[model samples]
Target: MSRAFTREVDDAPPPPILERAISSARNLVTPNGARQIEQAMETLDRQIEASGDSEALAALRRELRYWHARHARMEIVEPPEAPTIVTFGTHVTIKRGGEPKHLHIVGEDEADPAVGTIAWTSPLARALEGARPGDVVEFQAGGREEEILVLSVKGASQ
Candidate 1:
C-alpha cells in the first residue's frame, strides 16, 4: 500500500493517573470507622494484585494510596464511657420544629446523612458539641438559622 493512502496506528501509553486528594483536617475516626478503613485497604490490596490492565492498575493503586494514608493518620476517638453531652462518637437526638431527629456523630469516612449519621466536623455536629439535654443549638440551614433542641445524648454503640 502507498504510504499516502495508508493510515498509521498510534501506540502512545495512557496518561498518568492523578492521586486522590487527602483531607488536611485531623483524621479523627471512630472504632467502626477505623475498621472500615482497614477493610477498604485490604480489599484494594487484593484488587491491585489481580488487576491486569495498566490503566486499571493505576487507578487501583491511587485508591490504595488514599486508604493507606488515611489508615496511617487516623486518630481513634473512642466514645465517652458515660456521655452526658453531645460529642464525637456520640448519638444525639434533637427536636427541630417539634419533630425528633436522630444523628450519630462519626468520622468523616463513616458519615451517611441518609442513615442519620453526620461527620463530627459538620456544622450541625459542631453546633451540638458540648451541649447537654435541654440545650438549644443554633444551626444554619438553607441560609437561615434555626434552633435545635437537644433531647438526648449517649455514647454511640458499634
Candidate 2:
C-alpha cells in the first residue's frame, strides 16, 4: 500500500440506533414516580433542542421516546391511607436474618434498590404482595429460598 490510498466515506449515513426495551409488566407508578417520568421527558426535550450533534440528538430522541411510552402507559397508584398489607405504592418493613430492611414498592422505572425502593414486579415485591404484618414469606434469592418476616406495611408517606 502506497501513501494515503484508503478512501474515507464521509457521506455515508450513521448506523441506526436501537430503541429502548419496554417492559411488558403492568405500568403501575406512584405519584412520585409519575413526576419523575415527567421530569425525565422534560429534561430530554431540553437536551434534544440544545444538541447540535446528530448522534447526540438521536440518543436524546430515543430516550425521549422511552419516557413518552412510559408516561402514556403510566397508571398512577395512590398510596393507601392505612396500608395493612404489602402492595404497590406501600412501604414495607421486613425482617431477614435478624436484620430489618425497609423497602418501598414502586414502579419499575423509579426503582432503585440502593435507596430501598423495589419494583412492584420484582421477585421480592411479588413475594411480599398481599402479605400482612407477622406473615412469613418465602423469597428465592441467589438460588436459595430465604424467609422474610413482614414486620410492618404502611402508606408510602408514612
Q: lDDT tens string, model 1, 1-158?
A: 66787545444565688888888889999999999999999999999889898888888989989999999999999888679999898988999988999999999988999999999998889999999999988999999999999999887442
Which pairs of residues clash in candidate 2, taking residues 3 or more apart in a chain or in different chains? none
Candidate 2: residue 105 Cα off by (Å):
0.3
Model 1 whole-model lDDT (C-alpha atoms):
0.90
Q: What lDDT score belongs to each candidate, Candidate 1 first?
A: 0.90, 0.93
lDDT of 2 by residue, 58-100 (tens): 9999999999999999999998979888889888999998999
Clashing pairs in 1: none
RMSD for each model, in Å, please?
3.0, 2.6
